[model samples]
Target: MSMINNAHPGSSLVLLNLIDRVLLRKNKLVSRTELLEVLRPELLPKLSPKKKKDDEVDEVDDSDGTAMRRFEWNLDFWLKEGLWLQDDAGMISVSSGATQRNLPERVLELIIDNAKSQTDQEILDEKNTEPFFRAMTCLLVQQSYTFMGGETVLPGKNGSAQKAVNRWLPGERSLNLSNELPTFLQYGDFLGFLEPFGSGYIVDPTRAIEPYLKVVFASESKLSLNIFIERLAEKLPLLDGGRFRRLLEPMMEELGWSPREVHQVSPSLSHALVRLESAFRLRLDQASDDNSSMQLQLPEGKHRFVSEVVYLSEVNA
Candidate 1:
């Protein structure tokens, strides 16, 4: 829509057609809005044969609010799924789901294709990651991989009461039996409850490790190390390109930090920065595995942004 309004060579439907023709084969992102934002501005403007609109001057207002011109004229298309959450404090941006952009390419594709088949176990299971991801692209199983219970085949409907519970006293028996139990009725084991989310139950379906680089480390220790290392990396001419995060990768591997730090900070950080007692350990030989066959209790999400007193202007990365 933006491209078309800008004087693009085609209609909105034409832009969509271009997606299947060129974009899909490249393993590119599928969303039209996202693609427009990502596309080279020079080429995109060619699609629209219109002159650019002159910028509107800002209006004077004590309180911050959308100006009449910007809202009424500038907004080319309405955001259908846009949401603004207003609380006692102020308004904040909210999304439909899974806004994190740094997720791996395969994971991104699977999720974008409306397949959330990757399980919690798969997140931690490095060995099966390749095969599981390969299966996601297959026609028979992409969506099915996430749901083995045949959710895609048939429309969901209420089932017989007999399937609700495995056993019945006398009157509950019925002849209309498909044999397979209802999805809703099947109660997977409700074990220990994890941490509760702040934005209420709807958005936070389930809480787990944060992300790849950070999730692998205990919240406190990871932040602390990153903080200590980040400052050192910045101040000292230790690593070139300044992306020296992977430089410490060997040390992290040798120490078997994640497993050894399980549910708690490791000895290095725990001993120096965090004074908490060491909460995990392993036999001498078992520490070789990267997964460490162990893990620690992840701390709250916000704590992941640990900063240090560095010379550079206050930075957030």
Candidate 2:
């Protein structure tokens, strides 16, 4: 089943964080029932009905059932996608690969890995693309069209973003893009890839990439702008020149998609780097010649060229 159809809005990350916390406290894999028990109190309040008046009697609440279903959907999706694992006895724990990294990093890594593993056909399949591939498609569409003065207003009930997404998909598939688009937006916001702007969101991965600075830079204190982009693309393949972008290139071209620009840095990425530099997380240095300098797109249609990037310090979360 599609995550859009079965999963609750913003529940994936919430469930993952809760699972991690419970596992940490228990110090071992938790049985399904035990995990549910721990999650019940945390989830019910949000799902339960609120009384409008103090004198009103509480009706029979099915919130427990609702909470359980949501939890199961999130758990199943994560397990099937390898973000979470289940043992022979059905004991649940976060995947070994997901440990050690911060929560956002873990989720981001899992999303990229899962999306990359899927074939183009699988990604194009409406039934198979929910949550991960669909979310990625939405983000790309947001960057390509919405951020560039397109008609898609995110977080709007008008469904402009949904229409934009449907246009990117193969014409043969007649999937009704509705709730899933909004859900993807929520996930993007929570993961720090999309920042809320006015009534919508601006394509900004600054917060998303912040936690991974150490991992991205590794032992190197400085890197050429091109090298930094390469390293970042390796970790987050949804960026410019990333594997996902390359994979979608042929299909996108077949569907009459054109490159937004010939520049090495995308507008969204340039925006993120500029923000990072302003936050004192990194330093961007310009060279005398434009040969190796990457063009960075700034606010108000301004542009800055930088040839090298030096990691200063990690921004405290």
Candidate 3:
């Protein structure tokens, strides 16, 4: 689905070439000539579609200028996607807010809000991966296998998770378990979002992470805390809010709040909820500062906490 030429330089190639060129110059604005040199393979037509002898068709023929037009169109697409920015002088560079890890290599890891709005052609163009899937992976990773001195584990087997994934996906196209699943798993593992657990894989849930957290936090749309918690509970019924505390502790720790030193589960749960409230507040503050249109506001309340016993909507209200 090349929005530009549709034939030559498919969307994937155009995107990869653009990223390669941008990253090569350290994400700086490269000149048109520089981009042309980098994207020559895709830009140049491999063969003439058809030799046109008719004078009228030849006069209006944009064959010779196809490369330039394709480049311009693709650049505009990226700009609209907020992946790139272009100056009035015609220089192009990565957008200021695209600082979620070394973008060129991990470009696909980006999680955008309202990802479902993307056309089917656009999804296929971007390697057939879903943005919501990426957000779910981030949430999975945020969960921990152990808390304090006790072992905490996700409920059900890999089969159960796979079935849930199939049911959760919005579209009609079924996931290719053989080819696509492995690729998705490998990519998440390569990005350090997953790790080997006993016989299967689990999310890493590391503390010294911010870029990944930003990606997780960027899911402020349908994948908000209330929805996420509900989904997790549905998929893994054994994982109650108390178990979720273990999953959320690292984020709490990152926000300068210490996990309760007590080994009791109730106190730890309270501490985790307190930290989660702080994290939500901080995210809201950041959103306000950026003038983001994200509707992640908490309802009017004296106390706001993330707990399974209390529904998020009720607490916010």
Candidate 4:
């Protein structure tokens, strides 16, 4: 059996860490150091002034009527902002709900066009780019039923100095990674997802979001997506980004199935679906009493992304 299914489009905050700028070498672990560099600037003391003098007796001091104070500062405020790093190694890692590779925690979200092609025109279209970028973006904070309206609380610099580090990521800042964002996709790691979604359905969000990030810190590869399930699972939750998710309906028609059919029936949805001629040489194949050879596994219809896995030839037809 092909055993393919539409993926869920859940919401995710892909926090591209400004590890190079914000975080020092010590603070990079998600469990130990999330949001520290941005939200908790206090954790890292602001760079002090360097006083200089011509001679030892003429040394000039810029201290505020006192000597500079230094102490082991509390770093909880930085933890509120989501960070991406592997276990305890202290390197910036992309936060992941599933088993995914880690990237710098500096990205917010994504925007892209989904047109598949073998030429530059394909870059203009979102079809061939979805899987390319989807596989690149990672989850900084895992979406959970337990946490709805995300909130971050952290300890203060002092025992009684509690501070709520307001880290409201800008909608644009979170989606597009500044123009000229680099291409960060590792094809080997991202190809499996596109394997199922097909290269035609892939998209390169890097170009779409290139203009939205800080140009100085943007990536060259740009964010792109592929056909991985765990990554595709983040589609629905991103509805707030606007008209991106509505584009998934075509998959239903391509599968020789209708939204009404999937919505109306519950148990027989798999067998009830008509396979595309190109997908399976035979429209329907009997696998066993438990599972069918040709069946459509629809993602939960409550989100904002296309969650159907229809045959590609069906789409061309």
* lDDT against the true structure, each candidate: 0.23, 0.64, 0.38, 0.24
Clashing pairs in 2: none
Q: Score candidate 2 by TM-score against the native.
A: 0.78
What's the candidate order when arranged by decreasing lDDT? 2, 3, 4, 1
Compare the candidates by lDDT and give the number of the best one: 2
Candidate 2 stretches with Cα past 4 Å from truth are 6-14, 40-64, 95-101, 126-131, 134-138, 141-152, 170-175, 253-257, 315-317
- The better candidate by lDDT, 1 or 3, is 3
Least lDDT summed over 10 consecutive residues: which range in candidate 3?
292-301
Q: Which stretches of candidate 1 lie above 4 Å from their native place?
A: 1-84, 88-216, 219-317
What is candidate 2's lDDT per residue for 14-65, written digit by digit as tens? 5656666667667678898987777775444344323344222232455457
Clashing pairs in 3: none
TM-score of each: 0.15, 0.78, 0.36, 0.20
- Per-residue lDDT, model 3, residue 227, is 40
* Of candidates 4 and 2, the better by TM-score: 2
Best candidate per TM-score, number?
A: 2
- lDDT winner between candidates 1 and 4: 4
Q: On residues 193-257, what C-alpha lDDT tens digit does candidate 4 reach at each position?
A: 11111211121122222122223123322122122212323332212122222232232235332
Clashes of 1: 11
lDDT (Cα, 0-100) at 134 in candidate 2: 48
